[model samples]
Target: MLLTKVVALSLSFASVWAAPSPPPQSSEVLEVENAFTASKTAPKFKSLKASAAIEVYWHVVSKNSSVAGGNILDSQIAAQITILNEAYSTTGLSFSLAGVDRVVNATWFNKVTDGTREQTEMKRALRKGGAYDLNVYSSGFVEDPRRLLGYATWPWDYAANPQNDGVVIHSGTVPGGDNAPYNLGHTLTHEAGHWVGLLHTFQGGCNGAGDQVADTPPEARPAFGCEVGRDTCTADRLPDPVHNFMDYSDDSCMTEFTAGQAARLTAAIATYRTQ
Candidate 1:
């Protein structure tokens, strides 16, 4: 979840929007993911097949014809899908745009903040498909002071919060849009990481099993810019994974997910989402 927007001194498009705060990871969520990780070979468990197909249901919520007001083009949406596919290419996961619905609603377009009543109402009315399906909503966050780029519900949270089990992103964050440093369509990639039950690479900092992934080095905090060779938690002698999609790095900075992350994502989908 995006917490607050940091304004940088540089006026360039890439520097206008700073990295967002890492999303909160609860103990219960960690326990669930750990259990799945441990039970990969259990009798009831099965590995997600290669190139597991994930259907996407896109809901475009807009105030009017103005693209600045949340109305985005179909070409932008298609480019976003391409970006998502390329980012997760090595994770044995594939995303296909199954459906797209565009709505011109003032309230839902401008006022749907995460965990708010408006968000709940909008999702309940628009959410489609099952646990395996990904529902994406593109809207404006004018009502949110945080200016969130995006937010998502974990796969395990789907049962309890069926209506909220999806991802919501700022409309301008799509490709060729205004929210630079994030306009490359990587905000969805980060939130979708949360959707698949992957915690931030910086989660738990340098203390516990950071992100429950061994390959990604524990980061003391989220990396802002393209800080090459940045080592935050040097105790492990490993540099922070500023290039991982799970970090709060800029779109240009984020590149790939670790192999452990891919394995975890496979297990998560097999355990929680396949049902």
Candidate 2:
């Protein structure tokens, strides 16, 4: 979710943290696989009646932050949780804050990775929850925006990179914080959508498997700002879903997850996150 005046690919995935990519390339949908089939632990998702609130633990990292103490306030984090819950309130799923931990490291805070060196070290040392609780890490910057704003590990990626099994976001995207247009805290809402199993509404750009979900219309690219009544994929009968939480729309523009996404979340949780 590289949210400038316009939306850029979440991040360049060659190095670390795969989110939405640039215009020509695919979005995070390219990097994320269907973890529902990749899970080796929990059984396949079947029952829809199951409802459980997921626990999320926070790890705040800072050293050279532009902010005062480089640490986000507990109240801010709580408010972010409230926003997350609000977005997913209709789904049979939800998240509760487990706790918050902080680390003041300059080197780790500066560099994020994809199981290479420094990023792996950060995750190995700081990561907490196993397959259940969501471990969220906040840092100074993700190092590249021609690619990303935040990135999350797919539920299946946890087994291979257990330590890196969470989402990393900038400290300013929290509500009433910095990061305008995106200051509304929907960045977490979007990335967490990926953490579960959702994909960008414009996933395949009107081509191949679009986002792996039905009902969400396709777009040739990520939406910029809140362009309502805009349809990128005109050939398809359905209009582009800029208002979808998974798309790169502005925080204020993004609102809902399709029923397909809800079902996918249920299955994804059952298959990969059930603990």
Candidate 3:
């Protein structure tokens, strides 16, 4: 069953991932597939009836160029930790970002000269760290799906071998300005959704099948302009909630999880055991 599902899924995404350009070009939702589908060998945690008390060790790997001043890195780390808590709180999941606990040692100290190259190297190094089962390595690859978070790779934490369960938020997406929601919790939430086994509600394209999860409404594509109530899949009364955490909505407008989504996500997490 898993093999057939994977094969069918691969064919479904063959065109999207193969494209050199970013996804959602024409209401087409370009997203990571096989993110939730895990192999039997991987650890699966029984569903937590409620929020499970877990300590998440966070190691922020930053480049010298990124930290213009000493405080910038501190501020960014603080901000990210807060957001992660917010998402967890929403779902009754609890975690703490252990400061500088396990830094995935990297050779590159200078600014990421090449966004693509930096992300690639970062993933490789993360895979080496056996600390956490998953690592969210956010640096320069947030905009492009080809880079994983930015055209890089899936499960950003390669070191842990957690597969496509990790994520990255590009440095360019510091929470602020007009696209804060699209920036801050966007990638993390999306990737975290993958961590919990949720797929892009719109599936691969805006018009057709993407994620198999039911409660999540289908989106025409990744909506960034903050068009609330925009429905790509009209089969139902409520248009696809593109702005929902599962959908690609702008920063501020994106909020709330459907009851169905909440239930599914909670169930998915129950299937995985801590690394």
Backbone clash numbers for all candidates listed = 0, 9, 27
Taken over the whole model, the C-alpha lDDT of each candidate is: 0.76, 0.69, 0.44
lDDT leaderboard ranking: 1, 2, 3
Model 2 misplaced regions, further than 4 Å:
2-50, 64-69, 113-116, 145-147
- Per-residue lDDT of candidate 2, residues 46-108 (tens digit): 443455567899988877534543578888899999999899876666788999988888777
Ranking 1 against 2 by lDDT, winner: 1
Cα deviation of 188, candidate 2, in Å: 0.7
lDDT value, candidate 3, whole model: 0.44
Candidate 3: regions farther than 4 A off: 1-51, 65-72, 101-133, 142-160, 163-165, 176-181, 204-210
Ten contiguous residues with the weakest lDDT in model 1: 7-16
lDDT of 1 by residue, 151-185 (tens): 77776666666777888888988999898878999
- Summed over model 1, clashes come to 0
lDDT of 2 at 205: 75
CA RMSD for every model? 5.9, 4.7, 7.3
